[model samples]
Target: MTSRRSFLKTSAVLGTGLLMAPNLYARNKKYIGVQLYTVRDAMAKDPVGTLAKVAKVGFNTVEGATYTGTQKFYGMDPEQFKQVLDDNGLKMPSGHYMLGDGMPNAKGTIANEWQKAVDDAAAVGMKYMVCAYLLDGERGSLDHYKETAHKLDLAGDICKKAGIQLCYHNHDFEFKQENGKFPYEILLNSTDKDLVKMEMDIYWIYKAKQDPIALFNQNPGRFPLWHVKDMDKTPKQMFTEVGNGVIPFKDIFKHAKKAGLEYFFNEQDICPGDPFNSITQSYSYIKKNLV
Candidate 1:
């Protein structure tokens, strides 16, 4: 059997070439997005198809990963890639950027690099450019996070000109306590809410044993994006299909209006078998139960 990745490649290009009108999904209440990383393997093989399948699954929005070295959308140049989304009736309102990295000629300066990312995101009509991850030492200390907060403020300014916002996505590390408080708290308190925003990954917050609703309560309207993934039942905290894990996703979403959730994406860092199946199951669960 051909891998679903391969199938999507062949099917996507052909389907798109046929100039089929994009399918409509439950836009308002659902508002589900896909973290492109969840389909990275598929996208690497066939960018167009992977995206088409994502659209087919009823996702209205996407948060992107870099498509190969192009540092652009889905391995195609800007126009071609935008056409793909248009042809598929999809929208990418946000993107995961290599924040504080990827600058040219600075000999290890991250500011210029993040500037380029903001420029690209703006060109693509993305409202948000999100700092996706942090390496081992790159996370830095609370003070370093303070510095990052400042950089984020600058990035947010650049995006502001283009009518975009910059946000930070978190893993478990931000929850690490320091001086009787969470670094996440430090980041929240230090940053300008109007400028530097958050894309809270719900799974990671749960994994770190924090309350998503409480986070929302403490910092109301700071979170504009959410990675609505769930955690497995076991101690390992593996990413499971949404609503299939111990995380009380429904309860969390009950506060969505107050949480200021503008976009939500489904992401699983690793899939148990076929990643697409995991996605479909997650989509179905969200559509039927949560959305």
Candidate 2:
């Protein structure tokens, strides 16, 4: 099994003689984005056609995903891939990077993987690099979080050099109480303010019984990116359309400046129905209620 911390070390062969070509970045305001994970099935089947639909749905920004066997983006070289995104009126906002040398016990770093990540991202004109999610064992303890923060500071430094920034995305676990205080607090307190930033996953905060307003009040200007997702109203805790959920995004967006929100993307871990319809509804909610 590959450790979430490793990406380059998997004895897994890159059988194709392929090197990604670089393409210029596209800049446009109408392109509110969607994380590709939302349309995994669609992308897997027809990346070009599916991306065209995403643009028609009114999203111009996009994040990427990686599966166990495939490490490349949508199977296109970075250049070809960027051209595809730009042709569809979209740009890569961020990408989920599998950290490390792709090997167990590889004496490399999670940061090293990120260095390459930023390079690839820069090649395609991305402005932010984020650690998408933390897995169980790979999540080193609170001390490990601090250690991760150190690495992020360095990564942020690298990003800054390339005209990009580094951010950490969260799940419900970061809100867990540690000795009566939330670990998220420690992560926020310990990381260098200028070097590290956050991409708030609003749905996860709600799952942890935390309020986005209160979070904004406590740490203003710390969050710049957001995963604007919603939860179901039913007892099952499923994902639903944005406005239908319990989160008060209207109230949250009111304080966007103070919260340091610069960019946001619509994401749903699981949609109850057609993924396209789900995103269309999500986009409508954001444009009307939040943005």
Candidate 3:
């Protein structure tokens, strides 16, 4: 059987000689966006097909989650991936990158060939590049976060030159206090406001026992991106589709203006059934209620 990657390569080689309609997805004004990582398995198997399904489920925008390892977007080079997005009428305004300390061998990360990464991001029309997460080895003391913040500012400078904003996406660990100081606060304070911004993960913040509204009020306009997910009400607090959990999304969304949110992506790290079904449900709820 022809592998999906092989098929895509062949398809790319045989150009259709077609042009995408100008501003096709932009004209549609699709408000709902999803993180491509939500369907990681499917993306690994067939990114093109998965993206088509994502569009069919009513998501007009997507945030990419992989680039460093292969220096490609879902096995396709930047140009090819951009064409795939255009073919599906989807826009990718943001993508997740890494600091590279954890993956010392990884390329195209903030610590490696970051300029090339920024350039590729620009080619794909991305406005923001996010520091996805800090691996366990990368996080230790408050000083580590301070160092990470400095790195973010440095990377941000490069991204700024390419018309991209650099952001930090937090997990629950950032909220944990190290020597009585919250690493999250250290990050917010240590980085340049214009260069380094926040991409608040709603589920993680809530899980950490912090209030999103309070964070927005405290640092108004410092956040430009958000990872939207929900936590079930069970004791374990497993992941659930948006509006099917106790995250109080309506209340959190009310402060989007204060948060300076430009784009938000639905990202459920785990799901109960088909990831597509979970995202579809989230998209429907967000479209009907949250926007």
Give the whole-model CA lDDT for all candidates, comma-separated: 0.74, 0.70, 0.84
Per-residue lDDT of candidate 1, residues 243-289 (tens digit): 88998887888877556677889999998998899999999998888
Candidate maximizing lDDT: 3
**lDDT (10s digit) by residue, model 3, range 1-291:** 433233223323111211122121121224579999999999999999999999999888999988988899999989999999999999999999988998889998999999999999999999999999889999988888888889999999999999999999999987676565677777877888779888999999889887788776656666778899999989999889999999999988887776677788999999989998899899889998986
Query: Which lDDT tens digits does candidate 2 get at residues 81-144?
Result: 8999889888887766544423344222343455555666788888777777666765646787
Give each model a TM-score. 0.85, 0.83, 0.89
State, as a TM-score between 0 and 1, how close model 2 is to the true structure.
0.83
In order of lDDT, best first, we have 3, 1, 2
Question: Arrange candidates by TM-score, highest first: which order?
Answer: 3, 1, 2
Which ranges in model 1 have alpha carbons more than 4 Å from their true place? 1-27, 67-69, 101-110
| Worst window of 10 by summed lDDT in candidate 2 | 15-24
**Which ten contiguous residues of candidate 3 have the minimum total lDDT?**
13-22
**Counting only residues 3 or more apart in sequence or on different chains, how many pairs clash (N, Cα, C under 3 Å) in candidate 3?**
0
